[model samples]
Target: MHELTTVTDSAAAQLQQVRDLVALLDDAQYVRRPPGASSVAGHVRHCVDHYAALLAGAERGTVDYDRRERGGALETDRTLALARLDVVRSRVRALAPGVLDRPVEVSGIVDARGTVARSRSTVGRELLFVAHHAVHHLALMMPVVRTLGVSVPADLGYAPATMAFLRQRDGGTPA
Candidate 1:
């Protein structure tokens, strides 16, 4: 059997990147721009909340993350969201190696048809998914950042070889 090691360290590093990005964003960037779109910061807050749920489920052995009904709490304020982000990061980092040996229980609508689904996977896989999810959204956010004349980190995974070629073509240092 291929033993799966906990990706807690890499997750921690990604969380640090998220925190850095959050620090760099101002109120205008954090708030919603489009009438129907979620704010960029709101998406990060949602990702942190997902991490909190995953951590809780890992500890308790079960959780229903797909439940859309309010779980008896008001919407968290930005300060509270940041606090929860810190706590979730600490929890993931502190988890024992063996903790990820088992699969993670997750429930949610896997599609747009409003059908709810349940599944399980190793904690390491789940963390990898979460990291990639953040990367996916972060890329979508690049245009928004560029519109503000801010340069994003090139190492945010744009195929290093391609980036190097583009930089060389553009007469700049290869990233």
Candidate 2:
């Protein structure tokens, strides 16, 4: 297969995985967390928002994300969240094809001091960043989930179980 096709296939798979995981979560489990930290659903929605903007920015070649809108009530209903996840997935799917050639732009404030900074990176890169960000939050919430007495997914990981398994089967673990 061509490199672009491979890239497209991989991105599509990742996006689908995200959708699947979000679907698996219930509102109670979505919003429940440990003593301190955002709920698993909250973090997932936040990442979805970021990924949506990143994909759009990649298409437009502009950095247009406001981190101020990071964590907040994401719709108050699981149905709305699911709808929004579909929207995010649509945006990602639209950009994944063109992203191999054009890098997207991401802008954010450096500090609460009001310093703005902009950077250019591929949509693929931004997607990876968002995925990693989600993983970090998910890891933090894992313990929270346990405390809440919710059953955790058997295969949650920063590097996804499929990727991890592939790496392991290839003779070594993914670094």
Candidate 3:
């Protein structure tokens, strides 16, 4: 239960960071697209969508990443995105003790060949996957944030391993 709570809390923390970042941006900046880059809201929506799918799967025993709600108000409105974040955070915090260990089926396209695949997983495993997935998308948004002149935390999008390595290199205690 502790491990499951930790995993979910980590994801919630990342979402909070995103909410904080969104609060700092104006509506135009939130939705602004830099030349060839995705908007900050787009990146945020992508991350939130994964969490939504994962949480929904927790109730159904199956997760499908391909079927996501896209281009809704959450993709363009910072306030709406923040509201959705709160909802996701609440759901994560309320996860049942045995929920994480339950077996689950994950289905999605696996390659450019248009092949679909299904794999057995667990709620805890999928939580970890979404945590990493959020980090990946946040890292991708770093440049967009910079381009928009918005300041972000130094460790905003760093993976747990990466954060540990950085701490070690700096002669600090490993996270």
Models 1 onward score TM values of: 0.71, 0.73, 0.91
Q: What does candidate 3 score on TM? A: 0.91
Q: What's the true lDDT of residue 115 in model 2?
A: 88
Q: Per-residue lDDT tens digits of candidate 1, residues 17-71?
A: 6666555666566553445455556666656766666677777665445543332
- Among residues 3 or more apart in sequence or in different chains, the pairs in candidate 3 whose N, CA or C atoms overlap within 3 Å are none
- Per-residue lDDT value at 94 in model 1: 84
User: Which residue pairs of candidate 1 clash?
Assistant: none
Q: Find the candidate with the highest lDDT and give its number.
A: 3
* Residue-level lDDT tens digits of model 2 in 1-175: 5465455454455555555655666777777655657676776666667666766676688756674366555635666767776776666556544555676667887889988898877766666666566566656656656666655455554456556677679855434
Positional deviation of residue 169's Cα in model 2 after best superposition, in angstroms: 8.0
For model 1, the local distance difference test gives: 0.61
- Sort every candidate by lDDT, greatest first: 3, 2, 1
Candidate 1: where is the Cα deviation over 4 Å? 1-6, 34-37, 68-79, 111-113, 157-175
* C-alpha RMSD values across all candidates: 4.9, 3.8, 2.4
Clashes of each: 0, 0, 0
lDDT of 3 by residue, 1-175 (tens): 3778888788777777777778878899989999999998998898888998998898999999888988888887888888888898788778775898989999999999979999999998898898888878878888888898887777776777888888889955433
> Could you tell me which 10 consecutive residues in candidate 3 have the lowest summed lDDT?
166-175
